[model samples]
Target: MRPDLTEPLKLLAVRVERVLEQVLPTPELEPSRLHAAMRYSVLGGGKRLRPLLCYAGAAAVGGRTEQADRAAAALEVIHAYSLIHDDLPAMDDDDLRRGKPTCHIAFDEATAILAGDALQALAFELIANDPGHSTERSRLAAIRTLALACGSQGMAGGQAFDLGAVGRQLTEFELKRMHAHKTGALIRAAVLMGAELTGQADSHQLAQLARFGSLVGLAFQIRDDILDIEGDTEIIGKRQGADIARNKPTFPSIMGLDAAKAAAEDTRQQALSALSSFGPEAELLRDLAHYAVDRPS
Candidate 1:
């Protein structure tokens, strides 16, 4: 069964696609090859869910969704860069991403690495150059949001932890810590940056969204663990059961599937509660929280 309001999420996904293509750097320069490669990797198809979450988080706080769109696009650029590097032979050695030839597969390993580096820089540049939020405070807030979420304190740190923990047992708390930093940090950043984009720093709302992001972000990984157990590679894009194959310490590996499902549901409930004041307009966010766990991919 579908866990989302398919029509609305579908529309939002398309909007994110438009934002990415429109905002990503388009250069007319002497060496267009690398630029083209960067654009290709950044623009290549994915769910674009992170940016949509950013926009939704902003809108939940009565901020302009349009303001959040740029932030969303910028966050996605960082995400795409991570994927390109993650797929390199030096890393996961993945030859498939989003069910297509991975960056290192489509281009040489060197080009893939260069494209990832360039896209990472572009993510910061786009957020820092936001014309709408053109102020030192705005620029700093935007950069700070991305930096913390993507840096050693965030996704990169999570990856470092994951690399260290392979074939080893991690406590449930340890696992959650790793995922919160690696996967949930960007998810949270998407929302926080969306709010920052509009200069709406509602302390209560930010805290609520932060809690929601944490719940759903962890739940997202839990559900991925579930899917890795049951999903197909073709539909889910990446290899199913890869986590188990690698002997990774997943929620199911520690908590059992039934308990994991219950935990995910608990997280979803908390996520919805975080937006209780938004009334009916937060239906999409609530639906997404449910979907985060229920999605097959």
Candidate 2:
């Protein structure tokens, strides 16, 4: 029987929500304010794209869905933590996220900072303690993949590069490099972690998946740039033209609007091509590549 991705995605999302709820510290627990802030930032917001990518990567290698759950949840926790810090006064300073007040706005600035820090720690804990891995080596590898992605060489470093490039012109190559670290690293990690969870995917398959993740990550960022220009705040869940207001260097800024759209399509095609060796198991990944670029938000 042909599996329908729509139903499975819905189920996957439900499962992810449940796991996240269970995995995060309860808001009513001691240090209740921090726990509440963490829950406020992480739960009930955004499309869980990273987790979905993790699941897709697992499926690509014929891995069990259950085995992917912890990694997927961990990736999302990291993402949520990043958003909290990104919205702080010292950073992007945005007041809106996923159509609601940003974490610092909803909670006190101190709590928001603490929440972000705690979530980052929790992400590592989740992956390290994930019981689905068959051996300690596999778990360690997964931890290494995530840790490297979150550190200076990955998301944090990319963020530094992006901050430096603001109000400045950058070559297309430079912009891609910035996003590859800032936005793409965690996404790439999600894919690799999924494959690693299987403990069955060979080096060749992992390499191909990494390429696919990188292209899709670029496409996703380009689409975001486009949406910043074309989408309304009501629909996109964030202020439109915020990037232009901030003078952030983006794909459309470097390539022009028409060229940026073309670039997204080109990137998506490259991502799909990388998955050619896989069969039906990779359909979710292919669909996500399309959605990442085409989505209004």
**Candidate closest to the true structure, highest lDDT:** 2
Model 2 ranges with Cα > 4 A deviation: 1-5
**Model 1 worst lDDT window (10 residues):** 24-33
What is the C-alpha local distance difference test score of candidate 2?
A: 0.89
In model 1, the Cα lDDT at residue 107 comes to: 73
Summarize candidate 2's per-residue lDDT along 39-111 as a digit string, tens digits.
9988997788899899989999999888889889999999999999988999999999999999999988999
- Predicted candidate 2, C-alpha RMSD: 2.5
How many backbone clashes are present in model 1?
Answer: 0
